[model samples]
Target: MSEDAGRVPAEPPDLRVGHEERAAAMRALDTHFEAGRLDVTEYGERSGVAGTATHRHELEELFTDLPAPHPEFSPAAGPPAVPEKAPDRHPLGHRHTAMALLPLLAVIGIVLLVVVGGQPAGLAFFPIVFLLAGRFGPRRF
Candidate 1:
């Protein structure tokens, strides 16, 4: 009582009890996936990111019936609980200004040099101008 009463547990089994609790959470997740509440892609994705295989395996059991106490539990709680989340991420997708413009820039340069037969002395200068603009373009806030 003299020391801080609310200190983290400092023993191995107590630490393991935390793991057990996480396993319980995994079992809950398994329940969510089994009810068709979660799809294969989502189940796999979430399981892949899980901290332990025991958690991931329980997740698979959601798809296949494996006997357990209470088997799984679903809560009124929002989306299936993911103990971990994907790191800050952007979809690996194309931007219209990207795919649409890069090819055009190349095409125009090609046209000026090949189709136009390189007659214009200024044709070479255009690429340099575009390069400068791309390099130092103002970032729109």
Candidate 2:
């Protein structure tokens, strides 16, 4: 009956939703399912709807019947907080370059001793290097 009566009511704005939002919703759904709040059939149905949901509210609807597990992950909130840590690299792996060169040097020294200092000198060098390598090379135990 008013001047604005001719105008149609505006639809609710479609809040943007992405994989992060959908994944959070899924985690909430999983929590509820694990706690016996939702059955397999219901969980599967809600999970499917969540994965395909476009708006934020559409994803939120999947958890409407369940209680919130955490405030940060509630439907009203966006994505949950996930802390990232840098992977730890092997501490001793870098020393492998130097370790590899040790054997090559020992072989070269033995060859030179045989050519320049004769067989007796080369024979004396072999046992000394062998004992040193066994005693100081990479530990077995």
Candidate 3:
């Protein structure tokens, strides 16, 4: 027996394409035509070939001179890499720091209330909390 008898045949690189693949190639050809890369006559010719293409290489040949938006035949490298977020400078952010100071601000306000001899001037300090909250609050889109 020959050594080749034990080995299985490898799949062909130019695999047969399906309707979806042909349609996608046609779409890519449409994009090139719209971009002015292919004139009306060339566009019609390439599109016709794309429609009738039975193998992946035949579709690939249609885009040989074109840029991206080509039909993918090879397997993807891997899942996309997620970007790493930067570390926070302060773990307890500005909002938390502002909240932490609320009790101290209230004490200062009360002292002002007592020393100001019943004048409502101490009420001014309470608005600082609101200003801090507005400045440090979670941002809306």
Each model's TM-score, in the order given?
0.24, 0.41, 0.43
Q: How much is the lDDT of residue 92 in candidate 2?
A: 70
Displacement of the residue 20 alpha carbon in candidate 3, Å: 0.6
Worst 10 contiguous positions by lDDT, candidate 2: 69-78
Whole-model Cα lDDT of every candidate shown, in order:
0.52, 0.72, 0.76
- Tens digits of per-residue lDDT for model 1 on 58-104? 44444454343332323223455768876644363345345446645
Where model 1 places Cα greater than 4 Å from the true spot, the runs are 1-17, 52-141
> Model 3 misses residue 25 by how many Å?
0.3
Between candidates 2 and 3, the one scoring higher on lDDT is 3
**Which model scores highest in TM-score?**
3
Model 3 clash pairs are: none
56 in model 1: Cα distance from truth in Å? 16
Query: Tens digit of lDDT per residue, candidate 3, span 16-126?
Result: 877888888887888888999999999999988988888777888898888887876544235568989978866978666776676667667767786876866776666
